[model samples]
Target: MSEQTAPRTAAGDSTDRPVDRTGGGTGRGSGGTGRGSGGGDVGGPGTVGPEPSTARGEQTRQLILETALRLFRERGYAQTTMRAIAREAGVAVGNAYYYFESKEHLIQGFYRRTHADHVVAAAPALAAETDFAARLRAVLHAGIDVLTPSHAFAATFFKTAAEPTSPLSPFSAQSSEARTEAIRLFEEVLAGSTAKVDPQLRPDLPELLWLGYLGVILYWVHDRSPDQSKTRLLIDGAVPLVDRLVGLSRLRVLRPVTTQVLELIRSLRH
Candidate 1:
């Protein structure tokens, strides 16, 4: 069986840290002017137009994230400490704590930020296509695109994620929000698709699709092929089989199998 692959490039904007997409300018610069430590709120004592404090906070948060990612890439996740990241970001250790409660929180922040970028990247593809298989392929490719830029550091961090007891593990409740968001994106993929799935399979398909993505990611992490081309091949190959299986879900002959599969899935959820 040939392996699946995805679009290999950076997952989000090429920048190490993505900006606040809500249009609030989270400037990329590390030098946040603590100047105007005065203005705040919708209309507080010192300000008129939106205060610089929000921008400062955004910049500081991004700065810390950028610094921490750099350290993770350069020093490895296990070796990088929040204190080290704070020093590198030029923020007080306490300030880093204010922004992120722990190293795990920083990683959670990383997941949130990266997933947001993935949502952005996948949108155009989803909007442009309606075929379930095509939409799914595009979304999966978009996901890999978001992660590709950080390919260098992913495996190193996977060590932490692999620890079942670690909060960073994708299955951990701590990562539930990120996991849910990713699954919901897959639901969008299903909702927009023209293909018909067995209603029995419909509700759980998004999660199954996300699980497929996780499998792709796991493969990509270990993939050493030239440019991870094998991973791409895997995606290309898997899509057809997935499409076929989905198409078959509504067939009368497959009802029994689908019932058993759904039951097994439900069991695992508990």
Candidate 2:
């Protein structure tokens, strides 16, 4: 359902916390800021230096990423190269590789950046809505908003990411970090909601919601309608059905079926 339809509670009225839209976080490839000179040895092949520590270094890293995305949009993903990105970003080719090893890695950076933006964008809605359906709808809408700028690029890039063997695939090991973070966002949506999810199903629900989100993205990639309004309609329509199913999970009659579905999910994980 639309944001206008979602119910609110006193708890949902909490003030919003500040979010770091700067794409800073700890962990390899999490875009954590590092400490060091912005310039140094580029390092030999097969070896890379540390992440950007200084503000200047981080700025440089962001510059390269921004340039790469622009070029990816101007040109096609396949047509863009590291050298071109470095040149456009006004950094050495090695510096581009320093921040991101390959074009695939650049897309990974895009994933992290977009997710971070989605979190920031959804903070207001999350802070203001306690209904599970509303929170889910807000987060999903926030995701589409964050992704709208890259829609053209995503359409082209989907070909590569669709390949099972491609590192760009969302399900690939290379994408585990971003994927995990996305699932966790949904977990936050569930955790803060008033929905009484079945205890057995609670743990796996976030990933399932994430998969549904992927379905939405896939539809969005092909959505040629004005402003992708169709995709928004899809979300508005589907969330209530999801809410009903989640609500149904608490019924004793559905427990056995939920158990089976959980078993199926666990089996597929291995």
Best by TM-score: 2
lDDT of 2: 0.79
Q: Write the per-residue lDDT of candidate 1 for residues 1-270, one digit (tens) a residue.
A: 111221222211112222223333222132443222343222211111222258866777788888989998998876776557866876655455546656677789889999999999999989999998899888888888888878899998787788878788999999999999999999999999898899999998999999999999999999889878888889989998999999999999999999999999999989
lDDT of 1: 0.75
Per-prediction TM-score, please?
0.80, 0.82
Local lDDT at 41 for model 1: 20
- On a 0 to 100 scale, what is the lDDT of residue 41 in model 2? 30
Candidate 1 is scored at a TM of 0.80
Question: Model 2 — which ten-residue stretch has the worst lDDT?
Answer: 1-10
Report the C-alpha displacement of residue 5, candidate 1, in angstroms. Answer: 43
lDDT of 2 by residue, 1-270 (tens): 011111222222111111223344212454543322343434222223355776766787788899989988998887776667866877545456667756788889999999999999999999999999999999999999999989888887888889888787899999999999999999999999999999999999999999999999999999999999999999999999999999999999999999999999999999
Give me the runs in candidate 2 sitting further than 4 Å from their true place: 1-51
Q: State the lDDT at 93 in candidate 1.
A: 50
Looking at model 2, the pairs that clash are 34-52, 34-53, 35-53
